[model samples]
Target: MSQAVTLWIPGLLDALRVKEAQASLKDLKLPALQTLLAKADKFAVKPQSFYEQASFLFHQPGCLPIAVTKASAELDEFNPNHFWLSVDPVQMIPDRDTLVLVPGKALQITEQESKALLQKFNAHFAEDKVELIWASSQHWYLSIVQPVDIQTTDIEKLAYQSVNAFYPKGNAAQYWRQLLNETQMLFYTHPVNEARREQGWPEINSVWVWGEGKIEADKLLIRTDASIHSNHAYLQGMANLTQSHYCAEPESYQAWLNQIAGFSDPGNGEIDKHFICLDSVADKLDNLQLDEWLTLLQQLEENWFAPLLQALKRDEIDSLLLDLGQEYRAHLKPSHLNRFWRFKKPLNSL
Candidate 1:
């Protein structure tokens, strides 16, 4: 049996802005990545955000069950019977006539502040039969006794963009919108925001509600014996639900190989497939921190792409699939690495 690996890297191909950076693309020596792109067979996929791609890969095709999946990972005791939604805090910046959403991750919201904010929110909304639970500074959950019909856009898709077009839409849209407005008003005057204003940090002026759904048993598409490695809460939840082997995101390809080396022999035909999600560039890309993105790209070149190519050459892995976000997939085998005639392209060309 041969082992196969898949790498899901969002924002890998969105290098158009990198071209404008002071750093020359020619100066970035990512021979391994360049070669992989030059030689591999490419396939087009439907464009999707990181969360959507992860959900699709796990076989949940429609609106992502983000709340339930993430709750399973974040909560000490998760109840699948209750419907859940991710009501994460966000900074809504007034950009002229439009309001731009800044994701919670960029707000540097502390656990203390999150607790304080949720304490007030829960009390005010308690009569509505919905309770807010603080899972982390970046993730808060709403537990509802009754299911509501509403469609939401993930915060990842709405980050740094206008919120006008992406507001929740459905039968319960108006209700949610109103609730959001109320929450924003409540947070606007909170001491947390006052302190943040003094410190020059963005205020948590609003909450973004998304990832609403309950968990369905045995719905994951992943093989029971497959291994998953990621730091993402939803991905961890999927792994737990499927009872698949799961580990934290590895620091590098070498680190992953070392960690998995202790597993049952590959010859047993039980653990031939592996999925790894590398999202280091995700936040940087979302925040439009191009300089940091460039630095991380170089680190990826040194830590992952180079070693992965070597692994293919050594037959340590039979094949590799690169999910280079934004509707692109590249498949490569050891044989593909032998395509010396294929010219390597600059990283910016991707």
Candidate 2:
């Protein structure tokens, strides 16, 4: 099987805009990228949200990353049949028109704080068979005994946006709404919030439920001899369920490239597909840190883009696939390098 590598870069388009505005990349010679673009076999140029794109890669049909019932079970050897939902602790700020939920990472919740909150939630909802699990400060899970045919929004979609716009929508919407209301009340005076407030930290005033689903293995698309690596909790959980080797994302592609002296196969020799998710750019862009975003782009060009191009020229890898989580993707083959006459559009323009 020919080897393929996928890099999911969020906010890549916006960064391209920055490059264009400043003509910062005017002199940037990314021969591999230019050749890849010129030789792209399939390219989708429309705009799409990162969540939608990444979800397609890791999630099964109707399954979301936040719903870790199966993945958690796969990794922990627990039961997979259950309703799993991502119930993130967030701080809601009331805007003139609506309340906006702060991003979970920005909330800076601690493991101790999340555990405390989970304890309270489990006890409060014990009779309802709703249990909360703490994965980390920013990643939390909720397991329910029965399934709710509810369509919930991904918190990523709600971050900095009006909560009402993406509120629960389904037959069980009211049930979820009531649960959310009760959850807010349960957390309002909790000591955890009190302490965080005292420390000038954002209080965990509310819990947003999204990525709700029952684990369904049939939804995941998997390839034989392919290993998926990512830091995303949901992706990790899904990888567990899919029996894919899951590892932390390397600091940069170069760090990983340096370790692979000769790419015979990824460790096991059975794996040919290496998927690395670099999300720092997406995070910086989401937080509106333009300076940080630009810096990361430069770092990637040097460490990732440049080296990968050289490797491709040497036939170290057969193909490179970039799933930008936007509507567009770049699928490049080594032969695409010969199309020197193709108009070279700025990376962002594509």
Candidate 3:
């Protein structure tokens, strides 16, 4: 048994951030939530950075920490088998519940057997935490049991502890292999729309529970190009956090830009935009000499991002410009960057 393992636990309630459009949540208390996020900065996203209720997860006695997330949220009507998998120890695992961690399980175990198995484990060691881990159920028989290494970091090494009855193996390896091949093929220049991609029954992507020992997803491959521009608050926050937390000797925000700017989309891409909360980088913005921000944006458009994308990616990080309104644009030069919109709120003295 391993002694120490680093399980990714969603932070406590005070750490997460939750955000919504002001009008969408008029009845809700936002200041208190923002205060909570201000302290933790717990969870983040690509388009925005905010916390989620999942941050306060506390697993029950026997439940496993696993979740089924849809491959794409836009898809209508979720079929159990169409989704991706993520491990969230605090939320996924409930006490007395067993978590089966597999990529795409196709088989569903019988209810009676599943219940019996649950009773069996809970009868003696109900207080202990365990997992039924596997890659794919190709060559194995039905059902499995084993002691788990809670301290294991590498998921592959922490295989199942006990083995149950074996069954006739299927062409699962071939199936998974084909799935991976198809996924890559679908994303090329001539992308296939989801409606036309199905060959079988559901005609949709779905997640499933196999009878133990099944691989869930194919390898994930998304490349961040060498040169690009624009702002994605989530990515920005992640990059900032990475620099602050991982890099021993700290570097400037500009340096982060210079380095990440080297990567851009290989395909022709459009300019992306994002915003950073003023408070997060307040100190850094105080010192400005000779329009340094504009200088960086222009450089990125010409030599850095444009060439890489075979098009261009423009970024607008002018938080100052955001508040200045149209008055600044009137006297400014033609190239003063007029891409902005402002909305003023009325007094809240109701």
Candidate 4:
């Protein structure tokens, strides 16, 4: 039986901004990745958020049902009937004429802090028939009895960028914008922010509202046979929706191989398809930490790209699909590996 693997690597193609680091890339030996890119068939795709890309893979495209899908996975008793929106905590840095949105990952918000913050938010807006639900320290949800008509920008796109241009837009835009301002003011004086300030941590001063939608049973297009390996809540939720084999991502390619080797068959044929997301470089790329990004790339070269290339060569995997997020994808087979004449190119060239 032939097996195939698809890798979703978000920051794989981002350019290194630091001039000093450009030289370091030359020193980094990623021969396996270089060869795969050099010989594989490549194509362009419309730039999209990581959530959108994952949704596309699960056949739930267009304005992804991100909130409900993720809520279903996080919430103990998820009510698919209610409309959901991801009202995740964030910090807005005021810069001259704009506010730079810092995502929650940098905040390192504790569970106690999240619960305290949400308690205040939920009480303040309780009369509005909307409640803030704490899914995790980093993940929060807004449950609404009646869904509103507004489009939201995914927090990922707004991270480290000015929020002036990306504020929620649609017929109900003004309402959501007002709500955002109110929430910011509500959190401004909260003990959580006060404690965070004293600790030299970024304040969870506001919430970024996005991924507003309800999950419909008919909309769930599931492919149960394929295995999904990711640490992302949204993808894991999709796996649950599909009732597919889902597992947290392994530390490395070898670790993943070891995990699947122990799987027992339940009268079904061996699962030949796998989807893996390796997104560790995304935060480094977003924060412009060039050295860290290069280090991670080198690590991936050693742990994932190198092993995957060898797997393809040995026919352990018949084909490999590399989704190098935003615009570039590479498809490779064993024969492609034999294309030694296709000279390897520099990492940045892709």
The sequence of per-residue lDDT tens digits that candidate 4 reaches over residues 163-258 is: 998899889899889988999999999988988889888889998999989877677666666788888788788888776778788789988897
Tell me how candidate 3 scores on lDDT: 0.23
Across 145-218, the per-residue lDDT of candidate 2 in tens digits comes to: 67878787777678778897777889988877898888889998999988988888888988898877776667
Stretches > 4 Å off in candidate 1: 21-23, 27-29, 57-63, 93-98, 194-202, 217-219, 265-269, 285-298, 325-327, 338-349
Instruction: Estimate the overall C-alpha local distance difference test score of candidate 1.
Output: 0.81
For candidate 3, write residues 1-350 as lDDT tens digits: 00110111111111111121223233333232222122221223222112111111111122122222211121233233322232211101112444232321222323342333333323433343322222222111112233112211222222231111211124443443343233223322121213223433111121122222211323211212111111322223222322211111113334434443422434523222211122222223334332453343244334322332221112222111121111111111112233233221211100
Q: Residue 280: error of model 4 in Å?
A: 2.9
TM-score of model number 2: 0.83
Range of the 10 consecutive residues with the lowest summed lDDT in candidate 4: 11-20
Tell me the RMSD of model 2 versus the true structure. 3.5
List the pairs of residues colliding in candidate 4: none
Across 193-275, the per-residue lDDT of candidate 1 in tens digits comes to 99999988889999999988876554545467677888888788878766668888898998988768766765534776788
In model 2, what is the error at residue 19, expressed in angstroms? Answer: 6.9
Score each candidate by Cα lDDT.
0.81, 0.69, 0.23, 0.81
